[model samples]
Target: MFDIYNIGSLILTLSILYLSANKYHRLLKLERLENAGASPEEYNAYDKRLRLECILLIVIMGTATILSQFTNALTVAVFMIILGIILKIIINKCCPIPK
Candidate 1:
């Protein structure tokens, strides 16, 4: 009893989270007023944001894994993971966000 809908949902959830977190971080970095040089403050701030992104990604993926097990929808789960990865690649490849 594989449910594609659930898989799609999981995939959509992860993709949204990753895309949004990335956008938010990028925007924040862009907002920085520093010029010509990097400082400890900037490095720490960037590191913190990067850690947050990693945490969120792991949480989302873990949730998806749990949902897949409960729903017994391996196909859907795999599809969702693949779709998310593909979309991420496409976005990175096509849109550099004009830095």
Candidate 2:
């Protein structure tokens, strides 16, 4: 059966994963910048942004996961796992660790 709920679930899961990973990378980069002697004000601004991003991602993930409950449990679970791996690849490509 072609379930729209499943599709939506997949999309939301993938999006949340990507955004979360990207935010994490940004946080890491901010830390690197701080260690590289960024101004305290600049670091504080970046830190606040990172924290806001984390909170937003959490809300998005929570909402999406709740909505995903309408879909088949097993399907959602499997697709989520696959999407998570893909998200990892995207994170690596888009946000490599600072040297």
Candidate 3:
């Protein structure tokens, strides 16, 4: 009932916090890349991609929160977070970093 909505709202709030922390981490990465003499074009492209991912994360989290209203709160939150982590892993793969 109302608890479900509360949980969903909590999940949404956490998602925003997670996104902010992630953006800060990426900004640090960007600074390091710049210090390493990465080209302006490359840096700009990476920044653009990060911005797009942030936008998409906001949309997805919002949608999931709304959908949670008609579903089980705990299950919806767990699934959305799991899926987001998997996506983050995939994006990490694209970065050429060893797993």
Candidate 2: what lDDT? 0.64
**Clashes by residue pair, model 2:** none
Candidate 3 accuracy as lDDT: 0.73
Say which candidate scores most in TM-score. 3
Off by over 4 Å in 1: 1-36, 72-99
Deviation from native of the Cα of residue 41 in model 3, angstroms: 0.4
TM-score for predicted model 1 compared with the true structure: 0.36
Instruction: Give one digit per residue, the lDDT tens place, for model 1 in 32-67.
Output: 734445565665565555555455565547566656
Predicted candidate 3 versus true structure: per-residue lDDT over 1-99, tens digit per residue: 546668677777968797888789889989998999888777876776677567557766776776676878888788778878876776656643221
Model 1, C-alpha of 38: deviation from truth (Å): 1.3
Ranking 1 against 2 by TM-score, winner? 2
Q: TM-score for each prediction?
A: 0.36, 0.42, 0.59
Q: Can you tell me which runs of candidate 2 are displaced by over 4 Å?
A: 1-27, 71-99
Q: Which candidate has the top score in lDDT?
A: 3
Per-residue lDDT tens digits for candidate 2, residues 8-59, read 7776776777777877798788879878998776676666655554555445
Candidate 1 residue pairs in clash (backbone atoms < 3 Å): none
Candidate 3 similarity to native, TM-score? 0.59
